[model samples]
Target chain A: MLKHTPFHDFHVQQGAKLVDFAGWEMPLLYRSILDEHEQTRKSGSIFDVSHMGRLHFSGKDAVTFLNKVLTRNISEQKAGQSRYSLVCNESGGVMDDVIISRDVKNWILVCNASNREKLVKHFTKVRHDLDLDFDMSDQTEGTAMVALQGPKVIERVAGVLPVDIKALKRYQFESGSYMGMLKFTIFRSGYTGEDGVEVIIPAKIAGMAIKLIAGKTDKPDATIKPAGLGARDTLRLEAGMPLYGHELTQTIDPLSAGLGWAVDLNKDFIGVEPLRKIQADGPKRRLVGLELEGQRIARQGTPVLLNGQPIGEVTSGTMSPTLQKSIAMAYVDAAHATEGTTLAADLKGTQVPAKVVKLPFYKRAQ
Target chain B: MLRKKAMPDAPKDYRYLESHEWHKREADGTITLGITQIAADELTDITYVALPKVGDTVTANQRWGDIESVKATSDLYTGVSGTIAAVNNELTKNPGLVNSDPYNAGWMIKIKPSNAGEFDKLLSMDDYRKKTGH
Candidate 1:
């Protein structure tokens, strides 16, 4: 069964293209993909991200429990702060990358919607074997999440939010009221490479929250717009953030996916032994960003070639709306994954020239 | 040519394919083919178009080439079998014409119809809009 978010009716009313994503009916685009991407880069845009999984762990040993199951050291995280961490299966493969937030009363986990059930099962199995005292509660159905991202993010959100969003540092969150009616938990973090905030509120008030951020009426406003999965994918690609299935997979290790900073081998956790061995030996294939030289767009599954020999396949690619150039991510032999390395992408029948450039084709102005 | 949100309408005298290809029997009895305005609207910001070369034989309902928009890549299916007479080479340098002028500057190819009767099977404007569920 395809589940619908709280903002499904609103997206349909705005003429969004809805698609089945991980059994959830999600909006792919509210307007043109390029227009939405540029809007989010220049000004600010809102996204309905309620489909992500939300879990709460409460008790004295909540931090200790998370530290054992997750790759990052969660015990060091201060209250009101969020840290990006990964959950790995026993085989040392990434099960999911999540945001671990430490609150005064409990620890919260925000994981990918597709991997939510699997993570829950993994957590249950881990708790069964370990001495842990914490209550794991699935709060996804009752929660609604929205992201406000871009250069003018704070300025745009300040109109509807009573809190001073500018005071919130990166990865820090605050509880406040939205338009002084509903309580909202907003954090200064986003998938897009921009200064932004993500708001988590009750599902019952999701429609009202969207209206407050997107404006009540259907008037074309440049300051704030409703972006969709299409823009979200492109923005994250430009930001060099690895998507779960694309960059980091069951067989792909985090060290090779350019996420070594997120994994701490010094800490004892699930899948740490295999990760340590892989880290010591070094990964054979590494992820890198590619910039196609010509106008031809390299799509997913397009083969990457070096000197006419097939080396790897493209994971995600698009004509970057910000740069007006084609960009892609691929896992190539570690030797070929270097800046300024010449490469080619076999697009359809034609071989388009490409170059391995630095990750993150776009960055926000500080 | 400058781009607008809505592309120009197909030549009213031309026949349209359910898949959005425009088929026009030119004054010289040769047929010209290109995508329709609705197709251009759906595939906005076309970055590349791999057009069929001259003398390449195209079969009805078969893909002759491909067009890549920023959003997706779609196959260009020929509605009528024909021997290609010419292609818009300028489109290689400027593919945005696919959205700016889908019927004029975006015209893909000219061909001598292999089966002239195939044109009658093509869809009308109303039929195309119905097929696309517009």
Candidate 2:
């Protein structure tokens, strides 16, 4: 049986097409993928991200333990700051990409749902092996998360939320209590390439919190509409974000996934040595963005060819609703990973023309 | 039990395959084929329809072309074996017609069926509705 998030009933009432994602029965789309995608790009969309794993860390040893495990150096991260980082095995291959936040009293790590169990086991094993003393709790089941993303999101939420969301810079977070009862954390970060905030609330009060923030679902002119995993996937793909199972896996290292900025090579961590070696020798393959000539999508495992010879494979792809172009992210050999390089995606038996471009296919106006 | 969502009815004269392809027998004895509304709804935001050219041979229950959406790809099939007499060229430019008008302007192909008896072998409107849980 698949697990259900706190907003499951809300999704049903909205006529969502529910599907199993990472063992959680989640909404894939409420109305149509295109409509939701457009809504997110134009206004704002509330995404039920409660299925993601939310792990809390406390105790004096928490900082030391996280610095040793995470690729990003978090010792200098001040309270109310969040950083996107990756957890890697000893060999520097990514186990999962996560967003680690430094709260006033504790630290929060939001990880991929598919890797939640595996990461819990990995972190536990590491802590036991090292004999470190820290309080780690899986708050995923007790808490719910939602991301309200778009250009208009901050303004729409300004009146409902207590904190000065406009003052919270990107990657900053603040904890607040609503109605003198409901405690929550709002982080100005999101997966979509838009300005927005991700809020975490108590699981039992999620339905009420969403209604308060998003306004009535029946409102025809509501600022934020409910989007599902379908639009989320497409929106992230257009933004050139690397998904865990698609772009980052146990065998794919951070250097090759174009996540070098997130890794602190100078600091001590579980995967630092191998990452330093990879940096010194240079990565064999690098992730690059591809814009295809036609609307045909280059799905995962599609062969990326350079003059009829396979050089790499597509990891994630979609017909970008915003751009109206077929775009994909692929891992190509370092030699052919230039921005203007031309490649072909072998879709079944046909070769479709593709061109390597910059990482993000779309960027919002500043 | 969860409430079953209502689905649009398949045309009374049409026959359907379990995969959701609908077939209509035209006055010329040729069979016109397209995906049912359920299939179109399932594969939302149809981006491209890879249609076979005229004169192409399509075997019953075999994959002829591919229908791609923003999220997934599905193989288009027919219940009747036939030679492709006409193809929906308009879909090449606007594949979303499949979702907007699955029964009318979105008709995929017109085929000269090698065996007209195959159409009668497909599921009727009521059976198709039952099979789809509508």
Candidate 3:
């Protein structure tokens, strides 16, 4: 049986095409994929992201334990601030990417839902060895997450929330009452490379909050069409962000994925030695972005060719709605990963010509 | 951001195929062919349509061209074997027409059929609907 979120009924009412995603019935799109993609790029768009895992940790020793387990230095994470981080196995292989936020009273480690159970087990192992006096609890079931993203996000969400959201900078959060009743937490962060805030509230009031923000009029009817998982994939791909299962996995390290900046070498964390040794030996292959000539998209696992020989494979790709061109992210041989390098992607037995460009194929206007 | 309108039933004037292409016998012994409305809705937001050249010979139940959307790409198969007489040049710049007016302006090609009796073997509108389970 597939699980349903608090807003499942809301999605049905909006004429969304529902599909089973990660064992959960989720909306794939409301009207059309192109419409939703264009709307988010031009104005604003809302998304239901309640599938993520939210873990709470507190106590004097919480900070010390998290710093030892995560890739980023947690001691530098100030109150009300969030930092992008990662967790790795002993081999320096990426387990999962996370966001560690220090709330007003506790610390929250947000992870991908598909990796929740594995991460929970990874966290449980830390308790047996360390003398840390903290407790780890999963708050994912009790809470719901919604992301409002775009250039007009702050201007549109301002009318719904009670506080001035403009005062909050990136990677900051604050707890407040939603419409003067339900307690909520709003984070000025999102996966899409757009100005937005992620709102977390109790599961019961999640539908009401979505109605308030997405409803066309003052009534509770949800007239505003919501974006689905398809648009979410394209949005993140256009932003050049990494997906856990795609660009990151048990055999892929963060350094080879071009995410080494997030790892703090000064701190002694799990997998530090393997990371240092890999750095000394250099990565065999590196991830790079490629721009195809036309609308023919190269899908995941498509072999990337350099001079008629396979070099690597594409991890994620899409016809970028913002760029109006075919673009992809792939791990190519270190010698062929440089910018301006010409390459070919074997798309359905046809070697379509491509070019190794910069990481991001599209960036929003300032 | 063109919104998809509620698709109507397949026009009875043309014969449908299980692969979703529709073709009709023209008065001059040639035939006009395009995709069905159900196929259009399945491939939403058509961005590019790659049709064969004017003189190309298309075999029955075989892949000849391609259509692409924002998220995926699909091969286009024709149910009738014919020599292409005319191609829809307008679809080069406007492929979404294949989704909006799939039966008319979105028509892909006009072909000179190798066997005119092939249209009788194609699926009727009622049979097509049942095959698609629409």
> TM-score for every candidate vs. truth?
0.91, 0.97, 0.92
| lDDT tens digits by residue: candidate 2, B53-87 | 99999999999999999888999889999899999
Model 1 Cα lDDT, one tens digit per residue, B94-127:
8878777888888999988999899888887777
Clash pairs of candidate 2? none
Question: Residue A128 of candidate 1: its Cα lDDT?
Answer: 76
Q: Once superposed on the true structure, which residue ranges of model 1 sit more than 4 Å away at CA?
A: A178-181, B1-18, B36-45, B54-56, B85-106, B124-134
**Model 1 interface RMSD over true interface Cα atoms:** 6.6
lDDT of 2 at A59: 93
Give the candidates in order of lDDT, highest first.
2, 1, 3
Best candidate, lDDT: 2
True-contact fraction per candidate equals: 0.32, 0.54, 0.50
Ten residues in a row with the worst lDDT in model 3 chain B?
Answer: B1-10
**lDDT by residue for model 1 over A243-328, one digit each (tens)?**
98898888877888888898989999888999999899988888999999877788888999998999988999988878888999
| lDDT of residue B51 for candidate 1 | 83
